[model samples]
Target: MRWGEIIRRLVLIPPTLFGVAVIVFVLLRVVPGDPIAMMIPPGATPADIDRLRAFYGLDQPIPQQFVTWLGQALSGNFGRSISLHQRVFELVLARLPATLELALLATLIAVVLGVFAALIGVQLRGRRAEWIVDGGVGVLLAIPDFLWALILLLLFGVLIPWLPISGRIDPQIDIGFHSSFYLIESLLTGRFDVANALLHHMMLPALALALPFSALLARILKTSLAEAEDQDYAQIARARGFSRPEILLREVFPNALIPTVALGGVQITLLLGGTVLVERIFSYEGIGNMAIDAVINRDFPLIQGLILTFAALFIALNLAIDLVVTLLDPRLRHG
Candidate 1:
């Protein structure tokens, strides 16, 4: 990537984050529920209410509150959750890894399946094989993640009983608090049994989360691959006596992947946000589940922190994808 692009991405980060902060701060406050009212004991006196409000800084003017929160946020302080009574930063960090693990596993499944399916569609062209792939993609895309989660739970958890119905692992295993991330902790502790068990437990939930995204990616990839195959360079490669597989592997795949990379960035945000329902269904202890619980309990600080973190991650992923695409495609490097 050029220096201009690098500088541009860096410059946009602050304004984008500030916009997110402003929106979360203002809209959350504007909502009907009062955190102080929710936090205080039932039948508490006006004096008690005022004291609690002042304690949490909710009595201040909205602008001053925003300024105070923003300053603390910049210094890595997001305030304590009214519901959980824990620092918002620490609360999120604790559960973030579970969400990351789920998201990464789902993305891996999606990309692998999507790319291969697209490749098959491109190769088969107008044949029944291509039609089959297209139809399958359509069916998968038609279903939402939560529905998939329920269906998978019923099938694998109830009907077949092959996988554990809920939770990240069997309670018998003491995975310990050595690392916040379960997978990493398992590996570091040399607990292969726990690692295997974790992967097995994760499969159904990951597949549930991944299938729709894979379908969307497959559709995009098939179209892009077909277009790439028709390009002059692909034709030139064919003229040079390269086989179909060689042409696809060497020439078509890279060009076809550019749009997929961009779409994948968008999918990252969707997958992360959608994890709330999926996590709740699977009984997975992740930030998405935390967010859901926070909402139910009226935790404003926790909600703001989760939204800001997710927004920041989404923006950062798009930036990274843009840089990757620019680096991969020579045409993008110049313009």
Candidate 2:
């Protein structure tokens, strides 16, 4: 059943991408912005503008433009950016790792904080401490990630100035990177100092991006844990002389985590989306920051490429989450 589902999703990928491509292509054209005008100098002639439009294939009718772009994109050629004057694929690829690293770090922080909070909630169930925990979670949830970004910027970047507020790594480090995955490459090559510097720069932004999601995970996991504790398996464990901690660790926690893990996967995609604004605030050199640049400059090719990439990632993540949930739940696997 799982394999069949996976295959079905895989079959849907092409059409999914096609739909995303068509929508973005049309919407970008519909918006009141001329890529050629943005590219040309103020004194440029109408002839120059026409030539530039012809060069970028913007002179074609909308349907023809879409058809041409679709063919090129199908062959993995996403065209060049108007503002950046670089291939869209190359630009997106260059920045993708930075966004991915930030997302992964944020996910790690969120998961740890969430799990710890949930455990605390379980331990302090029905007590005054529980109210405190719930209140804190509520506050965290009330604020969106971007506002958290600004607050963290003001707090850590201005007054205290303990951490680097912008960029992925210090410009002074001058370390040679083999690939764009600076943190992983640094650690693999035993460059602990480089890795440490990267983390120092990333920590605040990642934390800002993490807090809301962590609060959400905490709420969900706490509920799941409370329910799991009242289940027959938990009762049986208690009757078998298991301590609260032992039952939680050995039985109830795993059951509770199944749902939390599934939800975490969905939140990760949202976290990725949130990075667009958060990255811009922190001046992080990720695709999200690039995305903002693309939008502002009306870089049609880059915008379409980035949105398509995001859509593909969302679909893949959803499929992977389904597989993971199935594997974790015996009923799903066996049924």
Candidate 3:
């Protein structure tokens, strides 16, 4: 990528993210719910609620509320969660790792499945393969992540008893550096038995989240590959008596597949975004659930922080995609 394009990408993402954060800041206050009231004891008096509201600046006008939030946020004050009574930054930072782990693994799975399906579509050129792969991808993409999560839950959680019904690890086991150390320590110490159990627990939720994304990516890749196969370079390879695999890989795959890599860098954000529903169904502790709780209780500072954090993530990923695209496609690099 040229220096100019790199600079442009960096410029584009942050302002867009700031805009999203501002929208979230406005919308949360405008929603007309009072977190102070929600968090107050059931039999608390109106006087008490008013006191709490004023303490949190909830009694202020919307403009005042927004301006106060903007200043505090700019100064790195995340405030406390109204319902949880915890530092919002601490709470969210604690959960960020799990969400990042889930998103990363899910993206890896998506790339594998997507590229494989695309490869199959090219190698098996018949109408049947095309129909099966394309149609399946469509169906999978159309199905909601939570629906898939539930179905998998029923199958593994109830029917087979092969996976944990909820949560990320076994309750009885000791945790290590990562999540429940039960799994991580076990794996690190060459204990396949514990590692296997951990994998089983993660399998359903990961698959539920990954299936839709992978299917969509696969469909996009297949179309791109098919189009590439029809280009002059592919015909030239065929005329030269190139092997089928060689023509597909050496000639067609590189140009078509590189674009998918660029696209996947952007699509990684969607995997993180989709985790809201997925994590709730699985009862996983992550940023998505934290964000959900913030929204429910009208915790303005917490809400703004979560939205800003996610928006920053999205922008960073998008910038990475743009840079990678320019690097891979020389035309884009020069353009």
Ten contiguous residues with the weakest lDDT in model 2? 1-10
Of the candidates shown, which would achieve the greatest lDDT relative to the real structure?
Answer: 2
The most accurate candidate by TM-score is 2
Q: How does model 1 fare in lDDT?
A: 0.88
* Candidate number with the higher TM-score (1 or 2): 2
**Each model's TM-score?**
0.93, 0.98, 0.89
Residue lDDT tens for model 2, 1-335: 36787798899999999998988999999989887777799899989888889888999999999999988987989998999999999999989999999999998999999989999988899898999999999999999999999999999999999999999888889978879999989989999999999999999989999999999999999999999999999999999999998988899999998899888779889999999999999999999999999999899999999999899889988888888889899999988
lDDT of each: 0.88, 0.92, 0.78
TM-score of 1: 0.93
Q: How large is the C-alpha RMSD of every model relative to the true structure?
A: 1.9, 0.9, 2.7
| Candidate 1: residue 106 lDDT (0-100) | 94
Query: Which pairs clash in the backbone of model 2?
Result: none
Error of 3 at 89 (Å): 1.2
Model 2, position 319, has a per-residue lDDT of 86
Displacement of residue 319 (Cα, Å) in model 3 is 0.8
* Total backbone collisions for each predicted model: 0, 0, 2
Report the lDDT of model 2 for residue 15. 94
